[model samples]
Target: MATVSLLDVGKTFPGLDTPALAGISGSIESGIITGIAGPDGAGKTTLMRLMAGLLRPDSGGLTVLGREPLTAPELRLRVGYMPQKFGLYEDLSVLENLTLHADLRNVTGKERTQTFERLLAFTDLHRFTKRLAGRLSGGMKQKLGLACALLGTPELLLLDEPGVGVDPISRRELWKMVHELADQGIAVVWSTSYLDEAEACDSVFLLSQGSLLFSGKPKDLTSRLRGRCLHLGGVEGRRRQALATLLCQPEVSDGVIQGRNLRIVLKDGAARPDPSALDISGPAEWKEVAPRFEDAFIDLLGGGPGGESALAASMQPRAEIRESLIKAEKLTKSFGDFTATDHVSFEIRQGEIFGLLGPNGAGKSTTFKMMCGLLAPTSGRAEVMGIDLRRSPARARERLGYMAQKFSLYGKLTVRQNLEFFSGVYGLSRTRQRQAVDSMIESFHLKQFLGVTTDDLSLGYKQRLALACAAMHEPDILFLDEPTSGVDPLTRREFWNHINGVVEKGVTVMVTTHFMDEAEYCDRIGLIYQGKLIALAPPDDLKADVASAALPDPTMEDAFIELIHRQEAS
Candidate 1:
C-alpha cells in the first residue's frame, strides 16, 4: 500500500524565486524504508515537512495515509515525524521527555508504561532514563528523540537525518532499529545526505536543486556504472598525489582515496588510460571494482570539479620544518571526579594529516579543545610550533587555525563580510585584508554569494566559506573538529582536496570525524575511548589489525568498531 503519494507537488517559500520543491511526484510504500536522498538544499526537508503537514504544497497534490495531510487532523495520530533537529528538551530527563511526548500523543495510563518500556529496551537507553537529555551523547540524544517519536505507535515514520553526527557503530544500530520498525509494517521515509544510508534503503528518491532526478532501487542506479569503476593501487605513500593527477584526467569522472588505493570512476564510454600515460610517480595497476552508490550519484550529478584546489594554489608555501608542529604531552582534563581526557599524548609532524577519532563522549573533543587552547587541561601540556599553549597563548594561537565542528560563522553576516572579519581577526593589515578577501572570493567561488547572508547559503558553500576564513591567514597548523559533518560526499571530497593541497604546502593538520571513510585520508589516527587513547597507527595498519579470515578486507569502520569491542573485552 502507498502510505504517502505526491502528484506533481510543488512548493515555493515566500520571497524565493525558485521553488523549494518542484513538480515532485513519488510514492512511499508501506513496510519498507524509502530514502529521500540529495545534497544540502535539495528540498529534502521541504518535502518532509509537506508530508508531515507542517507545510502545504503551493501546487499539485500530496496525500498521507490515503487523505490530504493538511485537511485530515486525525491522520496526525497515525504519523510520527522526527525533524532534522529532534526537539528533545535539553534540561529534561530522558524519562521526563518521553512522558511529555506521550501526553502530547495521548498515550495514557498502562499503554504509556508498556510503550515506554518497549522503546527504552529497543533503543538501549533504559539505563539513562534519569539522565538529562542535554548531557547525552550525540547517539543517545538521537535515540531519545526516536523514543519520543515512537510514543504513539504510528504506522508511518518520517526520520530526517537521525544518524548525522553519530559514530558508525551508533549509526549501524539506528539502521537496525529502523529496519526492525519497517519489519513491523511501518512505512519509513528516511531523508538523508549520506548516500551510503540511501543505498541501504528499499527505494530512493534522488533530488537535486528541488527536482526529482531518480526514484528507484539504489542497485538499479549503481548498475548503470557496472564496468566503469576501477581501483588504482601501488602508489602506497603518495596516494593523494596520484589521486590529484588521476582526477585531472578528462577520462576520470570521480576519484577518492580508500585505504592505500584510489577508487575512480571513468567518464561515460571512456576507455582506461595506460598507467604509463598518467603523470603520477610510481608504478600503478588498475583493478576493476564493483560500483558503489556514491559513484553513480556523483556520475549522475555530472561529476565533481577537476583535481586542483583553487584555494591551495593561491596560498604561499610554508617553510619546511623537521620537528613536530603540534604536540600534546600527557594531556588530561577532568570535571570534578569525571575525567574527560586521560593522559592523551601525541605529536603531529609538519605536513602530516593526523586524525583523532572516537565515539561521542569519548574525549576527542576535550583533547581537541585543550590543543586549541579553548579549554585548560588539568595536567600536562599542549604546544603548537614549539610554544606551550598555556604559557604563550597568544603566540601559539597566532600560528594555529581552527575550524569548529559546527562551522561557526556569523549567520547574519554576508559571505564577504565574514571573510573580511576573519582576516582582521587573524591580524592581517588593511591592504592584506582586501587582497585576502578578494583572493578567497575568487578561489572559493564565493563571488556570486558575496551579497547573500551566510545563513542563506547552502551547507556546501557555508563549509567553503568557513575553510576560507580558517586558511586565509596561512597558519602553520589547522585543527578541524568534525569539519565534514552533515555535508554530502561530494562536498567532503572537495574539502579534503583543499586540505591535501595545504598539507603539500607544509601545513600540519589535526582532525576528528565520525565518518570512517574520511579517516582513510589521515596519515595516522589516534583512537580515543573512555578518555584514553586506545589505538594509534596508520589507516592501513589499523585495518590490518582487525582483518580476519571471514573479513579479509576490513574497512575503516570495521576496524574502529572491532578495536572498541576488543578494548571492552580486555
Candidate 2:
C-alpha cells in the first residue's frame, strides 16, 4: 500500500506572479483510485507532478509512500507516472516501446514478458503489437503509454488526463483496467475532465485555479444537486432550442442539451415555466427530470436559469447556406485492411459550429486531416468552401483556420512575434494587421505577455495564443482539434467564451474534444466509434432517444454508456 499527502503545498513558477499551487492540501488513501478534476489553469497537473517528483513545491511538505516525493529515489520504484503527453518515440514499435520502458525500469525477462502480455490483453492491443507507436490510434497510444507506466507494477500510479480524446468504449475499458489495478491493491491517482470518469474514483479532489474546491465521493457531489433537476425531451428544434434558450434564463441554473431534450437544474425546481411561454414551432414536450453529477456541477458553478430570453437565439434570423463551407461524401480511409473512416458523409453548414465526437482512433483526426488536405483519402471526396481539397488544396485551404491539438507556434518566439508572423501569412494589409493584432492582444489578454517567449507561458496562455492566431485569419470556418486538452476548468470556460463569441459572430466552427461537457455546447454532434459515426444529432435528441429505450430517469451519460454497451453486445 502507498499513501500520498500534500500539506499546505505551494508552487510559484519563476518569473510568474501567481502561485500555481496556492497553499493546497489533499491526500490519497492507499489501495484505491483517487481523482483530481478541475478546469484548465487549475493546479491539477502541478499537484500531480509535484507528487511524482517532477516539480518541487515552493513551500509546504509533500510525502508519498512514507518518503519525501521530491527527494525519494526509492520511491520511484514504487511510483509509476504517465504524463499528459506521454513521450513515446513515434518511430518505435509498440513492443519496442514496451521493451524500452521495461529496460529502463530494470524489469527482467520473465517479469517483462508477463507484464507486457497482461497489459496488452487488458488494453486490447494484441493485434497491433507490431505497429509503430505513432501508427496506433490515440486511445491505443494512451493504452500503450499506460502499459509502459505499469511495467514495474509500482504501488502508486499517477496519470494526468489519461483518457483525453479516447472514445467512449475506450474510456470504459480504460476505467475497468484502472479499477482492476486498484482492486489488486495499487494506489492510482488520476486526473481527468470527464465528471462521469471522476465519479468512478474512490475519492476525488476538485481543484480550481490552484485551490482545492471540493474533496469527497461522487455521491457527495450528486447529493448537492438533489431536487434541482428537470428533464425535457421532444421534437428536434423545440428541444434543442428550449435547452439552449433555458441556459440563458435566470430561473434556470445550468442546463445540458442532449439531442432534442434538456436536463436542467433550476434555482427552484418547483417553479414552472411561465404559463404564457412563447409558443415555439415544435411539439409541446417538457417534463420534470432527475439530476446527475454534471447537473450538480453546473449548478454548483452558479449557472443561472435558461429562460425564454436567455435562449433568445431561437428567434434569431437564419442565413442561407454559403457555398460549401465543408463537404465530405462517402469519404473513406484505411490502414492496411482496417478502415479508419468508411463512407463518412456530412456537410458542415456555413456559420455553424459543428462538432465531431468519437472514441480514440475513431478517425476524427483522419477526417479533419482529409478536410485540411493534409492526408489523402482512400476513396470519396473532401471539399472546403466549394473547392476540392485534393484538386485545389491551396485554394480550399485559404478559407479555413485550424488550431492543432498541441502548441504549433515556435516556442522561442514572443507572443507578439508569433502574431506578426501569422498576420503576414494571412496577407493582411499592414494597417489591418496592426489593428487585428492589437484587438487580439486585448481580447485574448495577451498584452502582458506580448514580449514573453512561448515556452515560458503556461499551457493555458499558450493555448489562448494559438486560438488567437487561428482566428486572426478570420476564415469562414475554424477547425479545432482537442484545443482545450489539459487546460484547467476556468481557462476552459474562458476558451469556450471565445468560441461562443466567434459562433455568435456567424463564423462556422468545427471542433474535436475529449471533454463530454463541451459536447453539450455543440449545435450538433457526430459520435464516432471504431472509425465509424455511430450517432449524429443534437445532444438532446441523442439523450432522448436513449431515454425512450432506457429505464426511467436515465441520464445523458447513462444513455451514452448504454448505447455503447448495446453496440458492443450486438
Candidate 3:
C-alpha cells in the first residue's frame, strides 16, 4: 500500500516565474526507500518541502499519510523531516537536543528513555552525549540531526541531502539505518545530489527543471549505457591532459579521471576505433568498462567540457615548478585531556591537489584549522609559503585563501556587494576591486545574479559567490573545507573546473572532502582516524593496498571503511 500519494501535482512559488514541480506524479510505497535525484536547481528541494507539507501545491493533489498535510494537524506528527541545513541548537548538548526532539514528539515516560538509549547506540553517539552540537564536526552534526528526525518512530521520513558533508563510514551507517527503518514499515523519501547514494535505493526519481525525466530502479538508468563506456589509461603523469583532450572530442559524450585511468562514454553512432592511435595519447591502453550512476547522469545531462569550460581563461602551466609550499610537523592539538590532532605531519607542494580525509569528528577539520592559522596547535609547526604560521600568522594568512564548510557571507548584501566588500578587505584598490568583480561575474556566471540577495540565492549560486570572494586577491594557496558539500555533480565539476584552471598557474590547493569519488581527483590523500593520521598515499595506491582479495576492486568508500576498521583494531 502507498503511504503517500500524488496525482499530477504542480507547485509554484510566489513571485517565481516557473513551477517548482510540474506534473510530479508518483506514489511512495510503504516500507520502501524512494530516492529523488537531480541537479542543484532541479526542484528536488521543492518536492521534499511539498511531501513534508512545508509548502502547498498550486495545482492538482498531494497527500501524506492518506490525509491532506496542509490542513490536517495530525498528519504532521506522523511525518519526520530533516532539511539540508538541519536546524540544531549549537549550544545544546547532543543528549539535550535528542531529548528536546522527543519532548516535541510527545514520546514520554519509558518510551523516551528507551528511544534515547536505542538511538544513541545505533548512531554511535552514546559516548558523545555530552559534546556540544556546535562543537561537533560536520559529520557528527549530521548524525545528531538523524537522531532527532527518528524520534517517535514517525510513519514517514523525508531527508534532504543528509549526507552532504558526512564521511563515507557515517554515510554507509545512515543508509543501513534507513533501510532498517523501511523494514519496519516506515516509508522513506530521500532527496540527494549524490548519484552514488541513489543506487542504494529501491527506486529513483530523476527530476530536471520541475519535470520528471526518469523514474524506476537505479539500474534501469545505468544499464542503458553498458557497452558504450571505455576506460582509457595514458602514460603515468599525463592522465589529466588526456582527459582535457577527450573532453574536446565529438565522440566522447562524457569523461572523468578515475584513479590512473580516464573513463569516457562514447556518443551513439560514433565510429569506434582502436585506442592505440589516439592523437592526444598514442598507444593508449584501453578496456571496455561498465558504467556507474555518475556516468549515466553526465550522459543524460549532455556532458561537455569535463572540468573547465572550453572558453575559460587560460592559466599558464606550472609543470616544471615543484616546490614544497605548505609543511606541517608533529601537529598536535589538545583540549584538557582529549587530543584532537595527534602528532600529524605532511607536506604539500605548489600546484598540487592535497586532500585530507577521515570519519566524522576524526580531526580532519582540526588539522585544517591549525594549518590555516584559525586555531593554535598545542605543540606543532606549520608553515605556509615559507612563513611560519606560529611566528607570523598575519603574514602567512596573506598567502592563503581559505573557504570553510559553512562558508561565511553577508546575507543582507547583494551578490556584487559581498564581492566588493571582500575585495576591499583583501586590500584591492578601487581599480583592482572593479576589475576583480567584473572578472568574477564573467568567470562565475553571476552577471544576472549580481542584484540578487546572497541569502536568497540557491545552494549552487552561494557556492560560486563564496568562491569568487575567496579568490578576489588570487592568493598563492587555496584551502577548501568541504567546498562542495550540498552541490550536485554537475555543479561540483564546474567548481573544480575553475580551481583546476588556477592550479596550472602555480596555485597550490589543499582540500578536505567527504565524497570519496572526489578524492580520486587528488594527487595524494591523508587518512586520519580517532585523532591520528593512520595512512597517507595516492588515491589508487591506497585503494589497491587496502582492498582484500574477496573485494579485489574495492571502491574508495570501501577502502576508507576497511582502513578505519583496521586502525581501530590496532
Per-candidate TM-scores read: 0.97, 0.83, 0.94
lDDT of 3 by residue, 1-570 (tens): 578888888988789898888998888888989999888888998889888888889888898888988988786679888888758898999999998888888988998999999989888898889999998876778888988988888899998888787788878888888888899999998888898988888988888889998888989999988888988775455566557666667788877777777777888766554554445555577688988887888788786446454213633344444669999999999999999999999999887889999988899999999999989999989889888888998888877888888869999999989999988877787787798888888888899998999999998999988988887677888899999987888888787777766776668899999989888888899999888999899999999988777999999998889999988888
How does each model score on lDDT?
Answer: 0.90, 0.76, 0.84
| Weakest 10 consecutive residues of candidate 1 by summed lDDT | 273-282
Task: Give the winner by lDDT: 2 or 3.
Answer: 3
Greater TM-score among 2 and 3 belongs to 3
Residue 485, candidate 2: Cα error in Å is 2.6
Question: What is the alpha-carbon lDDT for the whole of candidate 1?
Answer: 0.90
Per-residue CA lDDT of model 2 for 273-388, tens digit only, reads 54127444455455756565555655666663233321112113335565657888988999898898988888887666678876666688888888788788999999887888
Q: Please give the lDDT score at residue 179 for candidate 1.
A: 96
Clashing pairs in 1: none
Model 1 regions lying over 4 Å from their true place: none
Clash count of each predicted structure = 0, 33, 0
Tens-digit lDDT track for model 1 on 1-570? 589999999999889888999999989999999999998889999999999999989999899999999999988889998989858899999999999999989999999999999999999999999999999999999999888878899989999989899998888899999999999999999999988889999999999989999999999999999899998887745677778888888899999887778888999999987766766656778899999888899999999766798888987899889999888999999999999999999999999999999999899999999999989899999999999888888888888889998769999999989999999888987888898888889888898999999999988898889989998988899999988888987888889999988888888999999988789989999999999999999999999999999999898989999999999999
